[model samples]
Target: MAAGGGSASDPLFPPRAFSPQGRACLALGSPDGRVRAWDTQSGRLRHEYVPSAHLSATCTCLAWATGRPTKEGPQRKKRKSEAAESVEECDLLAIGTTVGSILLYSIVKGELQSKLTGGHDSKVNCVRWHQDNGCLYSCSEDKHIVEWGSQTCKVKCKWKGDSGGVSCLCVSPDGKMLLSAGRTIKLWDLETKEVYRQFTGHSTAVSSLMFITERPSSESQPFDGITGLYFLSGAVHDRLLSVWQVRSERKEKSAVISFTLTEAPIYVDLAVSENKEEPVKLAVVCRDGQLHIFEYILNGHCKKTITSTSIVQIATSGKDDGSVPTPIPILAVAFCSDKQSLLLVYGNTLQPVIERVSLKTSEPHICLVRDIQKNLTLKMKTPILKVKTPVVKSETKVLVPGIPGHSASVKSGSSGTPVSEGKRKPGDKEISIEEQLGAMDIDSMKAVRRGGLPQTDSFAVLLVQGLESNDKNILNKVFNTRKEKLIKNTVARLPVYSIVPLLHELTTRLQGHPFSALLMVRWLKAVFVLHASYLSTLPDLVPQLGTLYQLMENRVKSLQKLSRLHGKLYLLITQISASETRQDVTDVNQTAKLVYEEESSDEESEDEMMERDSDDNWEEEEEREEQDVSADKEINGDSDPDPGEESEEEEE
Candidate 1:
């Protein structure tokens, strides 16, 4: 019931729920520990239970219970006064508080009926009532689950299930089995006063639990004695809902099925669909201000397969134009009495309201092709024919560069050959590769050398030629295609006079091919090292170095921004991971891994902070010394021995 973590817009008070008897009224809790019941149809307040200032505490959980009849008698007509008294006796609301006390308030009287205290030592996280037995079960941060008799307001049974404190509890309809979840999930047998079953596989603390029973055809009838023992457990941190089947015998393996959700769910409610085929529907109120409804079919073996899902976007604080909208987290969700609508409670501490949403939508129907005919055949009735058409001669006009004033017209045949050449005889000579290479010019030779160099000397030859050549296209091609492992050695082979053009080429291409920017940076460092003495005092290189400096400044700024964004995403992912499956101390046999958790509420002592500062300063000094040594090596033109390839295949 922690609702996990949220921003300022998230509701601060406890979550709400619809009444179990009729669900006509929705119960909402306030920050001041008051309970308000609102009519689901009219959206009006029906009852408000306000406590005294001394007994006031933030409401943490709410549960509704109808008072059981003291005795059974034959049905007979009653006067108006007797019927009104009966209604007042039946409606009761139980509110759990941060002080670990439970307040039972009569809805008809709009006042507290009884206060049950000294049951839990810590904050109560959940409270559930068993209508059949008139017993209330409550779990708290003190790691204990207490069952109190409603009439006596005293603890009937007390037991501990988890060491990390229980956050949620669910009572079986028959009051035989109890479900408790916190760091782990455990099932208890209320009658035997012992553990019934212990379920595993949830990597996070369970937030809510509900037994999925087969709803009867008539709403007036009670659940067919829990026709199915399947139940759902939701974990907010991991955004997962797992369905577990409780086996009647201890030896049978209980199957666990899980469904992943897009956002963390604060509350989940199940509704029985009117359609017989799709008998069950699930409603989930998520932290992103959206309502998700899942309609599924439950098989005989206790397996549920989702047939369809609908997502309703709830308007919180957004514009119609759809900009970046602020999310107002939903606090709770429940199905109305008719099961044709849903009620949602959302908003911040200042002003929270309940809204009703219709459940009806266009039902999807399958198109079935039922008719089938054997021996079906299709025959062509018309004969096909081939036709020959006359060919059209196309003329192309070419502008001759040598004769600028005159254009030449050329006619081509259907076979795509020039009409002037006519048809070539089979005996005519064909061109050879040797003739083509021999007739090539200087520019043609450069094009062949780009991709035609032998594997052995391709990188070395290209690097030297690219550096010496004035054309940037050749240099860029060489830089982009050269093997990364040979960069240091190949740059070392460049002549001292080619350093100026190499710097210019690297700087120019840095902006054009951003993917290769890091490779270019490495090349620049290598060039500066190889020709440090020859190029350091040359004033001709100053303008190029200034441009390179500016480019590097921009690159550094972009990387810094990316690093900050990555840190924020890492923080959120780690928080979720910690909440899901974290331990106070790892076992000795466990493998070492990175575990991220929130810092404690207590601030660091002055001595500890000072020590941390000193350590950081020492690390900074060591890094500076390392950088200085590397710079000295570069100046002395030292080459790394057997440097690994950096995968420079990325080219744009």
Candidate 2:
């Protein structure tokens, strides 16, 4: 989907909620009052629930109840029955709406269990579950933060200090302090219900605030030295993001980590890694539909900025460490205005592109490594029968244009007979012209292409085939080949989608041909080798590989249970060959096409066509109408002067 684009004045404000499981995101719609749950990993909507309990009022905020274990005690007969009636172990979702009401819904059974009213005089802006205490806290524009218990909706405590309405509210990690920002920030003691501190840094109304804990100390000691808990807040008028740290010095306590903004940040979200080694990263959603991720250091330095388009909300979850948090942080989720949601989990890795370049004679070769882990696993369970591993003939010839009289032979290895290397015999039909050209002028081919000449190399085409056997020896042999480097190089330069075209081309090239296990094995081995090499260059690719590896492992188990040894082997080989071949071809074609098109397009200029197309037809028509109307007015004025005006002029 295309990312959303608009001026800052027309900013979209969709209600967003974080899942209690931290595995998904919920996008709440206004007026229509529908809540849609989206899977974080896939960015797809999992389910939509519109509780009958919240029919008219729009849901403003949502919070998931953190299931805390109950205290241990002896089970009495009456108590057990009462417990069953009063408490049900289910996922509870608390939703605050526009009509000054709070609705608690049971998600497991998909039903609204309870409704509470009269807590807030105005619309509830935000709601959060307190981790330390089992109660829920909610703040509204009425300048009050009300606490609610399990059955009653009565306000346990009301924090009212700000002159303007409260725009945002958050509870500290320890749950001892509650922070609210409106025109100013007010810190309230959760236990005592007293205003403990007033933060007067922000010049304008504060939009959002979050509490973050730093990475744990290295020594096997508690985080006593880290008494200061940091808070990130953003302002609407100034578009500035400020970081404040609360620390105790001697007997007195103060808030630090103060900063100002260079640009106006509308929506701000903060995430501190739990890993302790990674730094705290803040994802800011700006009014301009731009998302910026900043790495915060202890000395108040902004280390790096990662920007994206049309990001509405940003969240992070993971180990509290000071490092570059992974794409799948321990916990991270971002909501986009474009109907899609992003979830950052614990183990997401980036995919790598592979490029194939010949090392023999300085020729640029490119191929994409296709991940066939899925297909391979399926084959492992249903191997093809009577399939022998085909011998890979290293005699494969590559044709290179622009470089004359250069020949290179790719050698293939098999268990039985090996073809002797020698000069090509006269009138040999098996050796194609393209192959001869590739073998003869590989270096010149690379040089000419590099020199902006048209490419005529056909060896760049990728061929994928499936193996019919699951022999470890075959797999080892296929992966342990010279083409391994080529495959690796190609895959590193291509995306997953580009590999599809290459696979289609290969299937067409080898029509009606019997499946060869050896060839398939060779291809699979080359692909695996390439992926392994690319993994080193792209650490983000690990998550993708991990997913494939898991699938392969599952297939192996299924094959063992089904007792389809040969079928499984065949399936594995075929899938591997097809995947690798498709990916390689797609990568080469895309790269070459892009390079070729860019070079070729500059030769011609279409100034006349551009001029003709640039004419504003709508404006021209309007101009013609205006000219005609002005001429009519001029003709009318000349044809007849006003009698009253003429008489007045004569009298003067």
RMSD of 2: 34.9
Error of 2 at 340 (Å): 20
Cα TM-score of candidate 2: 0.41
The residue ranges of model 1 lying beyond 4 angstroms of the native Cα positions read 1-13, 53-56, 68-89, 215-227, 249-255, 272-277, 300-308, 316-331, 345-355, 360-652
Global lDDT for candidate 1? 0.67
| Number of colliding residue pairs in model 2 | 92
Tell me the TM-score of each prediction against the true structure: 0.48, 0.41
State the lDDT of candidate 2 residue by residue for 258-338, as single tens digits.
333335664454445665556555555455433445554554334333222222222233345754322211222343332
Minimum summed lDDT over a 10-residue window in model 1 is located at 1-10
In order, the Cα lDDT scores of the candidates are 0.67, 0.53
> What is the C-alpha lDDT profile of model 1 across 374-478, one tens digit per residue?
243578799889765434345544222222123333434344543334345476554455543332222435535554423544555676676666656666666
Deviation of model 2 at 590, angstroms: 99
